[model samples]
Target: MNLYQQAEYWLSAHKIDQLPEDEGIEVAFAGRSNAGKSSAINVITAQRSLARTSKTPGRTQQIIFFKLDESRRLVDLPGYGFAKVPLAVKQHWQKTLERYLQTRRSLRGLILMMDVRHPLTEFDQEMLNWCKLSNMPVHILLTKADKLSRGKGSAALEQVRSELSGEMSVQLFSALKRVGVDEARKRLNEWFQITG
Candidate 1:
């Protein structure tokens, strides 16, 4: 089976203490609320409901894990920068996320999703900066490409590329149109050391 088909929901963790033992490679998906992170996961995995997508932003409140096999997994992190959530909950998320990013031994890389029209927000930059400090690899997906003209989308991609320096990779993606799915799969496979 393909890597996507091998994915199965494994567990969810609301607190750092609840996380599974660090033993395998894990690539995490992260973004601001309503940035289409879940939708992108669904599209990439070819599992329409594997990661729940909601019209209401900030619905995902925990770190969700999907096992690809015994030693490879995908992590869906809680969406940050939601205004409506209570301050206490937001603080908890901030702490949990920071701890995970700083200490998770199995984490191989991060897939940072951003909407095509609104590529970088303050929170996105914060995430990028943290990854930079930690020397972690990040792949930015400019999602919702169907919302823009092809020329505009390409221009946005170029602009983001020029703005970022280092090992980061950026791509245009559209869950609606299935753009960049293969490239995403290839990167994920490489990160997880999955072989055909």
Candidate 2:
């Protein structure tokens, strides 16, 4: 079976203390609320409900883990920059996210999602900066690309690329239309060190 097909249940870490031992490769998905991060994960994994998708933003409040066999895992982090959430909760998540990114030994890469039409909000820039400091690889997914015309989508991709530096990869994706699904899967497989 393919790596994504082999993915199975892994523990959810509500707190840093609940995280699994730092022994395997993990690639995390992060984005602002309503950026379609969960939808992108579902599309990439070819699993409809692997990560819960909701119309409500900021519904994912915990760090959920999915294991592709024993040594490769995918992480779904809490969405940031949602205004409706309480300040204390948001602060807690921010602290936890910072700690995870800075100290997690097995984190090999990150998949940062952004809405195609609204790429690079303040939160997205903050994540890019953090990844830069850690020298961690990031793949930016401009989600909801189907909402735009082909020319517009291509233009958005180019615009975002021109603004970015370093080794980060960026692509236009539409989970609803299955756009860029294969490309996202291939990059994730490479990051997870999974062989076909």
- lDDT winner: 1
lDDT of each: 0.92, 0.89
CA-RMSD of model 1: 0.9
Lowest summed lDDT over 10 consecutive residues: which window, candidate 1?
A: 187-196
Total clashing pairs for each candidate = 0, 0
Per-residue alpha-carbon lDDT of candidate 2 for residues 1-196, written as tens digits (9 for 90 to 100): 5788666667788789999999889999999998998888787888888888899999789999999878889899999999999899999999999899999999999999999999999999989998888799999999999999999999999988987777699999999999998888888878877667
Q: List candidate 1 segments past 4 Å from native.
A: none
- What lDDT tens digits, residue by residue, belong to model 1 across residues 1-196? 6978778999999999999999989999999999998999898888989999999999789999999888889999989999999999999999999999999999999999999999889999998888888889999999999999999999999988987867689999999999999989888888988676
TM-score of each: 0.97, 0.97
> What value does the lDDT take at residue 25 in candidate 2?
94
